[model samples]
Target: MESQESHRIVVTLAQKARDGADAQQLADFIVSSWQTIEASLSPIIGQRSVATLYKRSFYLASREHPWLMDMHEGMQTTVNLAALKAALLERTSAEIAAGAGAALQMFYEALTNLIGASLTERLMRSVWADLFPVPTQENSA
Candidate 1:
C-alpha cells in the first residue's frame, strides 16, 4: 500500500509539474491522493495524523525512489535529485507538512525538475495558443 501510494504521488507531482492542459486534473489528482491516505490512515492515526501521514508517505516513497523522477520525467529531473533528497531528509513536519505549504513547494520543485530552465519562462507564458503570440522574424528583430 505504501509503495503504491508513493508511486502515485510521484506520478501526480510529475503531472502537476508539466502544467498539464487542465487545472482540474491537478485538483483531482491531489484530492484522490488525499482520499486514499485519509481512508487508509485515519483509522490508525485519527484526525491529527496529517503531518505524520506526510512524513510516513515521504519516507516510503523516497526510500526506494531516491532517484526522484518518475518514468515520465526526463533528465532535467535528475540534476539535483541527490541534493533534494538530502534536503528533504532534514525537513521537519513544520517545514514540509502539506498544510504548512510544503506540498505546494513539492509541486513547484517537481515542476522545476521536470522543466529545468523553462520553468520561469513557461510561467510567464499564456496557456492559450491564440492569446500567446508566435514570435515572427519582425518581432525577433
Candidate 2:
C-alpha cells in the first residue's frame, strides 16, 4: 500500500511546481519542474529509462484526463517538454493544475514502485530541494 507521506510528497511537489504563478506562467513552471525531475533521475536510471517512465506516467494519467493525450501527442521526442509547455499554455489554470498534478503523482508512484520508496523519496527530495528552499531551524528564544 502507498503511504500518506508518498501522496503528500506528490501533492506538495505539484503545488510548489506552480510557484504561485498564474495560468499564463504555468507552462514555465511545469516545464522547469519536469526538466529538474528528468535531470535528477536520468543520471541514476539512464535517460532512456527516465523518458520512458515519463511518457508512461502521462499515458496512465491521460486515461483519467483525456486532454493530456493532446499534450502527449505533441511531444516529438521521448520527453519533449517544449511540446508539453505548449500544450499547457493552451489550458486553463485549473486544468493545468489537475492534469499536471495527476501526471506528477503517477510519475512519483511509478518511481516508488520501480526503485522502492526509500530511493524514490531521496531522489525526489533532492529535486524538491533544488527547486524550493527548505526552511531552516531558527534558534529558540
Candidate 3:
C-alpha cells in the first residue's frame, strides 16, 4: 500500500544503524534503503533504462551518501559501472548545492538493482549483520 500519512519517512534507519540496532532492524534498514532508491529514481529513469540509471546513480550517490558508501565498497563493478557512473553523474552547480542526497538515494537503489536484492540481502546478513548485534533475551537483560 502506498503511504497516505501525508508526510514522507526520512531515513531514520541510518541513524538507527549508527546507534547500533539489532539484525532485524538492520534488515529493515536494508530493505528501506532499496525502497529509497526505487521510490526516488524509478519514476524519472523509467523501466527501460532503469538498470543503466541504477548503475549511474549508485556510483554517483555512493560518493556522497555515507550509508551507501558501505554498500558501494563491496560492490563488484564492471566497465559499465564506471562509464555509466561518469556519464550520468554530472549534476549542475545548483543541483549539487541543493544537495546530492536525493541523487544518492536513487543511485543506491540502482546499486541494489544492479547487484540484485538477493545478493545484497546475503551481503547484509554476512557483512553488515556483524555491525549490529542480534538482540536476545541475554542482551536485553
Candidate 4:
C-alpha cells in the first residue's frame, strides 16, 4: 500500500540505478515507481487485492534482478507510451487490443535481451521449480 508518489520514486530509483547513480538515490526512485504503478493499476484491477499480485509479478521480479528490473521499467515506459499512441490511432477496440498485445510481445523481447536468453530461461525454470517442486526427468525415471 504505497502512495503514487512512492511509486514514482521507485521508477526514478530504477532509472538512476541503471545509469550508475548513487544507491540511495536509486532506492528512492524505485520506491516511487512502485507506488505510482500500484496506484494507477488499482482501479483497473477493481480491488486492492490485485496490488499484491502486481507487487509480486512486477515489483518483486524487478527487485530480485536488478538488470531485469531496469529493463522492464524502461520497456514498460516505452510500451505505455506506445499504447497511448495506439489507442489514439485505432478506432476500434480490437485494433487497440491488438496493438497492446504487440507492445507486450516487444517488451518480452526486451526483457529477454536484458537478462540474456539463457539466463532468463534459467531464472524462469528456477522460479517454476521453486513453486512446483517437480522432480527432474532423471529422478522420475
lDDT (Cα, 0-100) at 75 in candidate 3: 35
- lDDT to native, each model: 0.36, 0.72, 0.39, 0.35
Which sections of candidate 4 miss by over 4 Å?
A: 1-15, 58-141
- lDDT by residue (74-141, candidate 1, tens digit) is 32311222333344344332222222123423433343444553642354233212222343454333
* Total clashes for model 4: 20
Q: Provide the lDDT at 9 for model 2.
A: 40
**Candidate 1 residue runs with Cα over 4 Å from true position:** 1-8, 16-21, 51-141
Q: Which one is best on lDDT?
A: 2
Best model per TM-score: 2
lDDT of 4 by residue, 1-141 (tens): 332222332333233334555433333333343344345444544334333343234434444333323223433222232323332243233322222223223322333455556653454443323322343454333
**Candidate 3 lDDT by residue in tens digits, 80-118:** 333323322343322322223344345334445667666
State how far residue 131 of model 4 sits from its true place (Å).
31
Q: Candidate 2, residues 1-141: lDDT per residue as tens digits? A: 665444554455446444565666766767888899888888788887888778877898899889888655544336888778887888777678778877877888888899998888788887766653342343111
lDDT of 1: 0.36
The predicted structure with the larger lDDT, 2 or 3, is 2
